[model samples]
Each structure stands twice: as structure tokens, then as C-alpha cells.
Target: MLNRIASFALATLLLITLSACDDSNPAAPEEPVELDTQTVEDLPADPTVTVGENGRPQGLNQYTFFSLRDNEIVLESGTEARADSNSTAWDIALQGTTIRINGGTSGPGNGAAYVAEAAFENVVEVDTERLQPDTEEALAIPTGSGNGWYNYNANGQNYVRPIPGRTLVVRTADGDGYAKIRIQSYYEGAPELPADRQAHPSRYYTFDYVVRTDGTPSFE
Candidate 1:
């Protein structure tokens, strides 16, 4: 009728001008995910043990009993090696990378106060014995008795050796015999050593200790 109502209002104004045309060609804002970083030449220049961020193992790792705070070091036995582990009075606390000989005591000789509960095991065995848990007849550790039974400077006897990729086990409550020595000497980036039946481990960066005949002490 009036030209079909002006052609149906011009087809509803061209379908509302193509639905307010921006026809969606402007949707490009999504690009921000680039995180991949590791530089110390990408780590492991000479690493053998690394576990940092306080899960308690840093730099060089090995532990049996560790109680730490900062960068502490206390290797006791008449002390004089200190990084301040409370200036220990030799109650046997080999601070971090663990070794703690603490458990029970009543009283006896050869300076009593090391009675029971200090077990450790690694195991291989080749028959060896030496004791002085206070004395009886379980001898032969006299390889040059600085007062044998492991002539002390704190149990390791001033580097007759062990610590190259170390594994040490020592105990002598007398005839509870244990000594599998190593560590010709050490310090300065060392780790990864095996194929040692004694050669030139004399010292370059030694931190080696070998004591096979793995386990002992079970008074039950």
C-alpha cells in the first residue's frame, strides 16, 4: 500500500545496520607467557650434590644427624674447628652433612659417657676387629697407635683418609669393631669417586672415607 510501507521501513533499517557493525576484527590481546630461566651457565658446572632452598641439603650433601641455622661447622673432639656450632664442648656433633652421637650414658672408664644407641649401616665385610670400649681382647687397630682404637683427633685420626665421594662408618665401644678408612685429605670442588682400592687418593681434593662391613650394634 504506500509502496509497501516504505519497503518495510527499509528492511528494518538494514537489519539494524548489520547489528552495529564492528564485525569483530578487533580481538588480538593475548600473549604473555615466557618464563624459562637457568643461568650459572645453566647449572652443574661441577655439581655432584645440590639441594638448596632449605629442604636441608646444600652444596655437598650427606647427613646422619643435622641441626643447623646458618653456615655452621663444628667437628668436635677437644674442639678448635669452628664455624660456631655453639662452641661445642665435644658432645660429638658433626653439624651439617650429619653425624650426631648422642644417646644414653651412665658412667665408666676411658672417659665414660658413650654408652649405647648410635647405630649406622652400609655393609660389605672383609673381617676386621679392634676394640677398647673401655678394654678386653679384640685387638689389632694398632697401625701406629696414637693410642690405638683409632688414635683420635676426633675419631677420624687426622686424615689417614676418606672423603672422595665419601662413605664412612666408625664405631668402637670396644670389639664392636669398625674401621674402613679413607680420606687422604680434601676441600675445593670434589665429588664422584669410586674405583678406589687405594691408589693415589693421597690428596688433591680428597673427602673420601670407606668403611665396609656395613652394620652393627643391636642390643635387643
Candidate 2:
């Protein structure tokens, strides 16, 4: 029995030595303490509004300078877009010179900026004695398509020579906003003969008008 006890003691000592050998290397290095790194992503604003980089105004406006300069008036939003210009954008709902001139665009998609057609004749002031108040819209596209005059008439009787350096006041009849549209119109090239569809392909005399705004107009 004493020999067996001595043998057991020897076995226990060997087990301790083997266990110590498994962890013999400087505390087993604590699993190498790995540091983890994380990543993140950035996103844009709300998902409702459509954002396009194709010349949309700096402040994300729907209306641009080209839109205003090309047409006599424009609504800021595509929702309330009226078709007056003969371009592809014109729709049947806005046939002829049907600009409401309310000075704003209406609809769900309207952006921050709105543009109105800058007229060459906001106010047509002619000498009263020679008054020819013709309400007919003289749409003269002598060399034109994108922009021309409409709903404008000669409010004087006798046509007078355009005075040099004379500024006339044109205004927005729907509101206080107004601009000078024309200075004078006259005969040019050849007298255009009335036609069934097209105005006899001849250029007529027309007086140029100017636009006054807060700053140089912009589109995109």
C-alpha cells in the first residue's frame, strides 16, 4: 500500500509539470488584444424632391433665366406649366398668349424661384391724337420662334417716329409689377402680305424693347 501511495504522488507531480509547460511562455499573451475598426456612410436629404444636375439654378430653383428670357412669362413649377411658347414644352391647355401674370407659379413641385417672361413692352404709351387701339396681337416672328410679342396692340392713331433715348414704363397689370416692353415699331424689309397660314416670309419693321430687373437674369 505504501508503494502505491508513492506512485500516485509521482503522477500528480508530472501532471503539474505538463500543465506548467502548456502556459510556460510569459502568461500566454492574452489572445493578442485585437482592436476593431468601424465604417460609416453619408446620405442626401429627403426623398420626395427630384434633384437634377442639368443646369438647375444654384438654389435648386425650377425656373431658370433661359426659361424667362425665351418666353414672355413662366411659372416656377412644372405642375402649373402653361403652354404658350411653340416649343415642345407647350401643351394644349395653354394655347395662344394665355399668360395669367399672377407673378407666381403654383403646384406641388414648385421650387423656390419663380420666373416671369420679361416683356419688351410692359406699358404701351403712344401719343393720344393718333390713337389706333387695335387689340389684335401682332405676333411678328420675322426671325423668331422661341420668343415674340403677343396680345400687344398699337394704342395710337398715327404711327410716330421713335424718339431717341425715351424710356417707357411697362407694368404687370395683375399686380404692381410692370416693365417697359417696346419703344417703337416701323416698316422694314418689305411689307408682309397677309397669308392663309404663314406671314409672307418677309421681315417687317419692329422696335426693340428692354427689360429691367433686380439683377442680370439667370436660367440654369
Candidate 3:
């Protein structure tokens, strides 16, 4: 009888010890890491881009050329220019007259297109993971006007232009992913202000973009 009682006491103590251990060793909560696509000192941040800045970090100088091809961003300075392939030749291109994405047969998978948003500042998150090809919101922007992608106004003193304030949500070519682009400038390496047209040589584009290559629509 004493042995039986002692066994029961020990069992009860074991149960209590187990309970204490459970309470002391709770599971750790996971904290999600946020991703940003902004260029750092003219380079990409991480998991945000396979290719970082395609142009100079200080900014693209006049006539500099850049391209996004095969998941790599290439930048070079000089008078070299790329002819339009009209086929996803290059995923995207920047020149004096236009900022364009590949479309039609030249595009990847289904081809790439974009829809303009009110502004980049209004964007909080991109639903990239679930994005699909030929989304209804996409539009094939044209390179008609030399100022086709942006406009500038001198509010008496400063030259105001649409850049980060003008955002494009894109369905990338090959139907692989989604990217958000904010065109910062179209004149010589993306200068902040629009100087006198005669004073600034236009055509070079400086921009920022975040791409989600996972076929998802999330940019964050």
C-alpha cells in the first residue's frame, strides 16, 4: 500500500514537472522580414531584384544605355542605342520618346503590359504572387510624344514632373512575374528638376522598379 501511494505521488510530481517544462518552453513567434526594392548607392537591395540599377547610381548621364535582359540589368555609358525587337527583345526599354514594355508576339509567354496607378505613393502593397497574364487592368502604352510618358510644368519657379508620383503596375513578359515601376526622369541620368529643354539633353531615363519573380503579384 505504501509503495502504491509513493508511485502515485511520484506520478503526480512528474505530471507537474512536465507541465512546468511546457510552460517554460513556449514556441517562438515568427517575425516576417519586409522587402524593399529601392536601389542602394546605385545597387539593388536583395530578394527584390535579380538585376539592380541598370544605369549609373549618381544617375544616368546623357546618351547612356541600359537594358534588362535574362534577369540581368546591364548599363553602359556612350552613344550606343538598341533597336526595337518588337518582340520581348528586351523586357523593357527607355529612350528619349518613351518608356515601353514588350507586347504582342515580341512579348514573353503572353507578353507584358501595364496599368497606370494614381501614383507610386498611393501603393502600399502589391499582390504579386497571384498575378496572372493579360490582366484586364493592363494597357499597352505608346511612345507617341517625346513627352509621352511624362510631363513637366514650371509652377513659376520649379520644374514639376511626374515620376515617382506616376507609377505603373506591370504584368511581365513570359508571364513570369509582376513589377512596379516609377519613372524618375527622362533627361540625362534622371535629374530631379526639368531644366530648360535647350539646357538639358533629354532621352536618357532614370527610374526605380521592384519585380516579384515568383509569378506572384506581391512587390513587398
Q: Whose TM-score is greatest here? A: 3
Encode model 3's per-residue lDDT on 1-220: one tens digit a residue.
Answer: 9999999999999999999999999999976545456531222211111233675223232222223324444433333453433345345544333444555533343445444545765554654443333333543544342233455553554343553454666666556656676766555445666567545444445566666666655554
Q: Model 3, residue 193: what's the lDDT?
A: 68
The digit string of per-residue lDDT tens for model 2 on 100-126 reads: 221223212111111124332222332
Off by over 4 Å in 1: 1-123, 126-140, 143-179, 186-207, 210-220
- Using all chains and alpha carbons, the TM-scores for the candidates as numbered come to 0.21, 0.21, 0.56
* lDDT: worst 10-residue window of model 3: 40-49
Backbone clash numbers for all candidates listed: 19, 23, 14
| Model 2 worst lDDT run, 10 consecutive residues | 38-47
Better of 2 and 3 by TM-score: 3
Candidate ranking (lDDT, best to worst)? 3, 1, 2
Model 1, 7-97: lDDT tens digits are 9999999987776665655668886433221111111112233577887534342211211211122242233443433332222233122
Give the winner by lDDT.
3
Task: Find the 10 residues in a row with the least total lDDT in model 1.
Answer: 37-46
Error of 3 at 205 (Å): 0.9
